[model samples]
Target: MSVSPRRLRAGALALATLAIISTTACTAGGGGGNANGGAATTLTVNTSFVLKTLDPGRVYEATGLTAVHALYDTLVTFEGSDVGTPVPALAESYEASADATTFTFKLRSGVTFSDGSPLTADDVVFSLNRLKNIKGSPAVTVSELSVSKTDDSTVVVTSATPNPNVPVVLAMPSTGVINAKVAQENGAKDGEDAAQGDTAQQYLDTNSIGSGPYVLKSYDPSAQVVLEANPNYWGDKPQFDRVVLRNMDVQTQKLTMQRAEAAEISLDISGKLLDGLPESLQTSGVQDTVYFLFLNADPAVSAVTSNAKFNQALRAAIDYQGIAALYGEGAAPGAGLVAPAFPGTLPEGEASTRDVAKAKALLAEAGLDNPTVTFNYPAITYKGVDLGTVATKVQGDAAEAGITLELNPQPLTTFLDEMRGGKSPLGFTPQSLNYPVADSLINNMAPGQATALRSGWTVQRADPAVVAAGEQVTETLDLAARATAMQEWQRLMNQSSPYIVLASNSSTVVATADLTGADYSAAGWQVDVAAVGRR
Candidate 1:
């Protein structure tokens, strides 16, 4: 349900104790009043693996993105589920070079950070440069680009290559502009030494300085985060006076929401939890993430998995529809490498149906007799669905095709280490992208990329046709042409690749029926906290 961007690997957190829940119920409940005796509304959101960091340049995890998104505003942003289009946020307007190599932005006038400092082009330049130099997980988002200030209200970004998605990249939470003066005073640095010289993470963990709707009031990585409305916010005032995000496990989340405990909204909820849900709660979702199975192609790791025919057999044996059914509504059989929410995906019916006969035939053609393989996966629940449960289903399906799978479930951290080190011959995990762009997904899954390399599929060993198609997609500048290239790439990948598309689960959010505007988006910030309001 999350990755390295929470993209390639999802992290895990221990379940909160019942005492913590009781404490949260007392402190973070909704519909309360302030000391002045006036109505003060608070929205409580339940989620796990949050509060990793508040620094925008370093925040890449799903929940971390959610926090940074509220505290900071990016130059461009996706509006209300329209992730395909990027609109100005901190920037009033922007222009891109015809070749798509350069972009110039005009900062919105009269915007102020939480500290009441005027927004300046220097802040935008400092933020982007610091993001690149921090060498954090999110730094890769701007690795190919350079940013500079041209004037007090103008900033320029130049790319090393034609990048039609630069605007979309700017919308990423990692690019959120910060108050440079305050950040510098707190030890934030720019240039190549920022990875070591930047020391503002600790300070930023509890303090926020941005031109967004909410400001950080308190942060406790082990418990919850508190936010208050920013009085100096330049945009529409938020309806809620405060918001609280609590860290709770999936079962706890389900229990809390179903019982109307302390939270009004729940994140990372599985579709299975929606069954017989009370009418007092409403749900909204989008198919924003995919769980996939990949077999390492490195012969040194596993000769059996390196076999092309065996890979084909494994793909054929998987019951894609059955996996989708596990998540219930809002889930679907994954059609290609890309998640279903984005464009360039294969049509729904195009996914291969389970064919036991074909799988057995392929295995026989590979000259393997009842080949036994180790299927390794994380032993944790992701977005309410247990990975072990999914792995068990896959194991059973493989058995039907005359294959034996020795399921090895490891802790999330250990599993991630082994997977990233290419030690797992066969692995099952979910990859969630930082942004909702087809090229970002393609680049991550393409040959010689992060996902492929993690699966031991390097350019030297990858199919020339598939590699060429991926290159074409990245090199194309025109949107229509890029889409065509992406399609061809997926076609070739499906024919022969280490990864198999399994199921795309919906990014589900359940909110109290009294709440309105709890919309869903495929972006890093799954739900726009600033937009939620009581009916």
Candidate 2:
């Protein structure tokens, strides 16, 4: 779910279902409040969303993950922010082979889907297979895996390689379990050709049939997604009878909260905008998204940026602390490319410290002076942080070190095209993990991987030791051993990699003070709407 902001789509039509109107509209944000200060019947949340589909197997963006989470339950899930371990959800217990290639899960008995149908191993098998054969962006998480049903209450999964983190991978929202019978009747396919043959997406856009806390009431791509409490929900009933996730901008979100007009929680407000907020509003910071800049290693793009000496100079010149400040409180200098919450992330003290003298000296050593490089970034406020402001700060800091940065901000689509095609000599962007695992972040920087390919880094050009360390980290399943291997990889990357980590920003959620379950998590759905309730 690369933290890139999704632009608004045009001409999206809404479903004809009537909306559940909030009661007592004059109360603090959560709609339909009791006249005498009791529980609210409806919860309204506002955020700038990039929602494309409601289908669990196909959703890959942040907002889509949040929505799918409420509608469907995964085989396993993390508690609070404890991503280090996965707790059972649909599966009551699970076991992995010593070789880490095979896993068996025992489904929880008596669990029923929203439609009151009994859940079985068949649903688990169908969900994982549909996730894989559909070949959507999320399919990468389940790559090299096969799922099968052993009995009504038992299921087994196998990986092509020794993947110790299969449970953690299963915790991803994309792996949410679906009602097999209902989905199949609605045109779902799990065969290898499902990528083209699967026709369940349109059906899922309006109908949600899963054993989760909520069911889809209606969905509008451009406007809002509405949910109602599932009568057959296996767990404790959700606090609100109705939850409305509206696609409203941050400005409207702030105004709504201030006026006590509608929305109770806001997921897209910038940290800088928190000042002067009313006393009724409270905020929780989830610092997980890591922002970075990368220089293309391909000489065809720019011989100067490809030079190792120039890369070192630029890394030394940038003021990491100053950049971290731009994200306001809760932000910090990135410890490594991995988010700080991940177990294997580098220690805080290992973060970069700027030294302009070293930068100038390195530039001289490279036999270059007064060199100018064009810096490219998407010209939009992604997740409330304006890249242009960050770019201007970087440009100013670079100027002090005798380097010139030519800022070229373009439309997000064009910028992404150039960056992905390796046409951008230098680029700035933020990336969020698709799943909560160290491998999800570190693996991208490996030779020939997604981020590496974007930066023109190939195995032949990379340090052999760095590549070996990365592989070791991925192959090692032991927690402490993997942490050691991750540290070595980060140390090597800090030395020569084209990527320079800027800062990790906190994802802030502004809500009314009385909201009880405004909890935050780095894994799936920054904040769980199902958990939100009045104090």
The lDDT per prediction is 0.79, 0.79
Cα displacement (angstroms), candidate 2, residue 74, comes to: 1.2
6-79 in candidate 2: lDDT tens per residue? 11111000000112322221111112223223554888888776677779999876677888889899888876
Model 2 TM-score (2 dp): 0.90
lDDT of 1 by residue, 1-535 (tens): 2111111111101111122221221121112223123577788988875446778989877777888888899998976555777888999899999899999999989998877779899999999999999999889879999998888999999999899989888998889989999889999998899998999987777688788888887777678888888877899887787888888887788778888833388886756766766666767777777788899999999988989988999888989889988877678887776666666666777876798899999999999989988999888776657788899999999999988999999987788889889899999987666677777766667778887888889888889999888888888888768877787888899888898878887777777767766766777787788888766
Alpha carbon lDDT at 166, candidate 1: 90
Give every collision pair in model 2.
23-32
- Which pairs clash in model 1? 2-6, 3-6, 3-7, 3-9, 4-7, 4-8, 4-9
Clashes within 3 Å, all models in order: 7, 1
Q: What TM-score does structure 1 among the candidates reach?
A: 0.89
- Taking every candidate in turn, the Cα RMSD to the unseen true structure, in Å, is 5.7, 7.1
